[model samples]
Target: MSNQKDHHYIPQFLLRQWTGEDGRLVRFYKPHATKLMAEWVYPSQVGFEKHLYSTRNPSRRGRNWLENDFLQRVDSMAARSHAKMVQSPVVGLSDAEMSAWSIFVRTLFHRSPSGFKSTQFHSIRIWEETVREIGPRYAQMKGPDDPETIDEYIREGINGAAYDQVLEHFPDTMMSSRVGQFLNNLHHAYLR
Candidate 1:
């Protein structure tokens, strides 16, 4: 139900750093098979896809929950960290700032179209393997209304619904957990 439609995988604050005096950055892309195109466009105009992070499920909190709730917070924190790093790359960041920047970098990767595709491919592969391995064990626990066999359960009940759930939520979960691990294991030292 959220009003936001455009979601930027690359944060505007980061892109703004490269903007020209006219407040637009030069964007280049292939417009067609025979043409390459370039234009001066606002950062907001180039980096977003409409409803890229939107969820279709009515039971969820909001359609734009990922964009409005999670990404905005990450971008806000990273904006501060980015400013500090811009001012002084080596010495400006505190431990918290470093952590924020790390999270932002990792998030930027996972949120981009290419990264999302890659993650989706891997996640689906993993999920399919997991379901194949565990689906039979859980078949005995099925209620009267459920599919009679594990194979039937997988095909008739689990495939579409579970795949959608995994596709919708797994990237966020993976990003969060990986960021936590990255922060926990990170060590900083100055070498002369």
Candidate 2:
């Protein structure tokens, strides 16, 4: 999937979502220290969904603005608007998810030796120790002569479970409000 250039949205959206807060997304790729670096650690060429979502119709009925050629131009404009409006945008993670996602993103950015927890939860350690514990496993799993790639190596040892488990330790109310809004949006968008 990674090599297939056509499947752009999944990675692009995930990467973008990592950075954007609420309605705003980033236009330029900045370093990790910037809070605008939210969901993604890398700069990505904007994908078609972002392009489609930003397009508008010419007021002629029955025309699919989503499929229009002019959309690309609009996409650039939207990207710029997104960048300008969201300069230093902050997407606060729930306290539960906060530490976990921070470490997850940091591990991705640093490319430090670490693996995701798959079987059962491990003790939460300071970032440095966490990397140390994970270093050996990462070394074992990472094959000789394998090229280092964040997407390939860090993909495992991580799943919804890792996020969910850490998140479970947090009081439900901490995220219930956000989850409720997400569910409501999902319902309206898909089930309506």
Candidate 3:
């Protein structure tokens, strides 16, 4: 559950499940709401941290071990949040807040020497742009005139089937490069 108490901050799409797929979940909501979620979470920082840890070259059993463990935990948390976003969409942040997060993440990635992690920025950015273009109604059913329960908004977007829509709508080289960098451990970020 989100801590946002203001009703005005909650988007209607977060009230229900939208789409689904096997192995992965799908959530739908208005484009604006999706944009908010995509940019608002600051997913890029996770990538930046990952890149930093990978470059550290930790000793067999030294502080590097602890650092690596911490980075893994952060990565896990980021992955969980992304999965939840697809499994259960919740909109409680305003567009401005989300944009600020994106900007911050972008700045962090840009400045980090381990900019390899910033590769994920393209995927998040594309998702945010798509959400802005899709419109809320196009993604999920409209919520009630007055939302008493925020859970409903979260529930409405969790669809297990619409996962393909993401790939269909947001196929980008940057996403591929990020994935490649994660798998190969080398940074060739010319796509950005």
Candidate 4:
């Protein structure tokens, strides 16, 4: 999956930026702090889903009309991306896997205008960590020679009872609220 070469809403270079030197996904990618995203991060190249839900700098008043108009279209693509946020775009754990994780979880991490309980937030945080970190950690356990071990570990993390137990800690309200319902619907359509 890592080598599939698919389109990305959040650029892989950017995502790799967030990875810790030890290969964990830290909150920020600190290694290349001075890199400028000007030529690299282009909103026009992103898909509608990413444009709508994941775009970070939507209203910067671009240098030209075309850029500005494109940004507006990106904003109007809100049917997919509605969290008009700048600065920190994606944060923490997410329902999404691989490339989709950061985009899907941005709203949960911020954007809702209301906050979540520490327990609920922790459940969310831990769940994503469990899904993401399990494979690499598993390699450390079983030795790094088995690439299949990563897949097995990920499957275990997803289908395992331990994963289910962590989810059980997530607030029911977090799953039942309006925002939760919206996420559920979105999941059924795109993720499930």
| Best-matching candidate per lDDT | 1
> Clash number for every model?
0, 4, 27, 3
lDDT, candidate 2, equals 0.35
Per-model TM values vs. the true structure: 0.76, 0.18, 0.21, 0.21
Error of 2 at 115 (Å): 39
Per-residue lDDT for 1-192 in model 2, tens only?
111222122223344645645544555445766555434233245432322211122233222332232222333433443343344553333443333332223222211112223212352323225545665566566667543643443433234323333323323332245554554333211111
Q: Candidate 4 clashing pairs?
A: 17-29, 52-81, 53-81
Candidate 2 root-mean-square deviation in Å:
18.0
Query: How do the residues 74-146 of candidate 3 rate in per-residue lDDT, one tens digit apiece?
Result: 3334333334345434433333333323332333343343343244345445544554454545435444552
By summed lDDT, the worst window of 10 consecutive residues in model 1 runs over 157-166
lDDT of 2 at 126: 36
Candidate 1 vs 4: which has more lDDT: 1
Model 1 steric clash total: 0
lDDT of 1 by residue, 30-128 (tens): 979899999999988988888776655533657777788778888898899777666633466776777677777778768887776677667767766
> Candidate 2: deviation at residue 14, Å?
8.5
* Runs in model 3 lying further than 4 Å from the true structure: 1-67, 88-192
Q: Quick one: ranking by TM-score, best first?
A: 1, 3, 4, 2
lDDT scores of the candidates, listed in order: 0.73, 0.35, 0.32, 0.36
